[model samples]
Target: MIPMPARIIAVCNQKGGVGKTTLVTGLAEVYTQMMGKKVLVIDADPQYNTTSALGLSGPEFTLNDVLYGDESNNQKIFPGVAADAVLEVGEDWQSPNHSELGLIASERNLASRERDSMMAREHRLRIALKGVAEEYDIVLIDCPPSLGLLTVNALTAATHALLVSEPRVASVEGLAEIVTTIAEVQENLNEDIDIVGVVVNKVRKGRKDQDVWIEKIRTDFGELVLDPLLPDRELFAKAQAAAKPLKSFGSEAKVLRADLEQLARAIWKGSEA
Candidate 1:
């Protein structure tokens, strides 16, 4: 029997283009392929970048329908395109047109629903997701680049949060804001909510400035900073354009693969703790 993986992790950072969607999608793939776990990704961002990166588009039914409208009817829940439709990255770093994975696509229309709803009902995403909590081994929520209703709902629903940051002063500053927000959410909204750790992405090794910022973040956050930083890689951008993940690309460079794998294990073990 597959052990029940009931952890819900939210990848959040108040800064856009900081690899939030990329990390979530990549980690989902790792969890499925490496750990033999079923993972569900909830793209809560209006950009739908995660949805697109996962090769899901033209959504008929999305999280919006579940949160704002109604998914009480079985027919109303639309499973996204077949997994084989997703682009795949090969071992030679070649691109292919197939994958064996799953994703719950998101739509830009979700923003409109947020605007129409009152503040209290903003937690609809959290409430809606609770219904399917047991369906998958893990659920990853990709939050928007702001502390809005969408982000709050993600934080409230998540058992833990992974604050992704780039090795830059601005990105670290943005992480601070997210940390503060998580504290607020834990105190008032979800007492069980805790920060899993901070993931420093796009890290350039041996750079003096990058090392400085990284050390500062470690000093400030201490054990909250996860080791094995995700290095900046051009392949990631290429995979995104082709709508595939890095691991699919088949490049077995030890550093990048090890970092991501370690990240997945860290999250899993942290949840267990």
Candidate 2:
């Protein structure tokens, strides 16, 4: 059913501080460390939080150059070999907890892509992925917190999406708006694309506002919601600061690791269906 090379999932939310990048990094580790699958993470966000979270600085040819640079000559910045633009992370890289991860990093120049007058700008990402299709079992794109050209490009390239959101009224509205965009992209760009699941991140206990919106999200999206909800935890910050996953934090991260593993399996299983 699913066309292959990899199951590409765009971990996206057009709202900041919603744990979008964290989900991408977490799932990357889960697929690599836990499931023993290779993962290629596309840091499509100009903010490059995913690139930072993975403990990597910007590389020579980031997604920006691959997509928007001098394309009249070569298809990618790495000349004839596109996968060369994809850099593999070492076990010692940022004290990596998962070595089965490769990255198409992003940098500040990606922001300039929006102002580009190039044609079929949104299709560039899809083209780049195809160039290196044989290299990974899964691809995760961390989209920027906006429905801009970069996000649209990721959506067009992805087979499914994990829409992240905080549990709030505004967040619910954001989910609806993103779903609308997904529908449009499906109709016009990538018909096989879909929002496979909704991740309710940054959930706070005992907050009446959060409780109300959590119920609202479940009611509106129903079975699309994937659990268990990622709690607001301090270890997340510590792990990112250490350039490692919460699971790499050892015993204290048991609960965090379990939650992410569950979510990751849910995503892969959904892709199968």
Candidate 3:
């Protein structure tokens, strides 16, 4: 099974094209299909890549509803519970094990909220998630590639921050900024939160530079760098293109499925450590 007691992890990175969305969607698929865990994925990113990759559409009363509730029109954005805002996507990949997938789909309207200068914008997501934290074993929030209000909101609501990163000089160049943002959030927004670890994404084997940067991350963050680094594989691209989970490929991509299982184990114990 996946992590217990409901974990809200923001698989985030300030820079785009670093496999942020891929990791989030992939892990959700792993937890549900392999372990039969109830996983809730919040596609907080305006790009909505997670929604599309999972074959989900932006439904009515989406995350936009919670972020910009119309108090004047008596529109309760978090109607009773945040569970009311989620929709199950596609079909279960693993049968007889109760693998369930839930999503809070996003739309282009989500980008409009970026202009919102109100302080309430940062806490909007956290407040909405509180209404339904008890319903799932794990909740993954896919953040946009910017450390704006949306990212801060995810940091504020999250129990742990699972930073999606690459083992390269260019990728780690902005690591300082990411650290600063998380520090600010902890000092101001959520004191109980912690950065669980960093997942080095799509590490191309035999790259000497990758070895150098991998050592750098460990030296800088210590135990915060999660192990069993995910490799760059063609299967990842195929799975996304197929709009299906890695496990859905069955024996064709069994090795990819094993890689994801290792990732899940590393994240499952993150909260306690």
**Alpha-carbon local distance difference test for all models:** 0.74, 0.81, 0.79
- For residues 43-132, what per-residue lDDT tens digits would candidate 2 score against the true structure? 999988888888788588888877765667643333224475788663433323444678888999899887765667777778767747
Backbone clashes in each candidate structure, one number apiece? 5, 0, 0
RMSD of each: 5.1, 2.9, 2.9
lDDT of 1 by residue, 1-273 (tens): 644535889899888888997788778767776677767777889888888877765877676666554335532322322221222222322223322344566788878765655445645556565546556678889999988878988898788898999888888888989989999999888898888888989987789999999998899889988888888888777777777666656655445666778999988888874
TM per candidate comes to 0.84, 0.91, 0.91
- Candidate 1 regions with alpha-carbon error over 4 angstroms: 1-5, 71-101, 252-254
Candidate 2 regions with alpha-carbon error over 4 angstroms: 1-3, 71-82, 90-99
Candidate 2 clashes between residue pairs 3 or more apart in a chain or in different chains: none
Residue pairs that clash (backbone atoms under 3 angstroms), model 1: 89-248, 89-249, 90-249, 90-250, 91-250
Ranked candidates, highest lDDT first: 2, 3, 1
Q: After the best TM-score superposition of candidate 1, give how far the Cα of residue 5 lies from its true spot, in angstroms.
A: 7.1
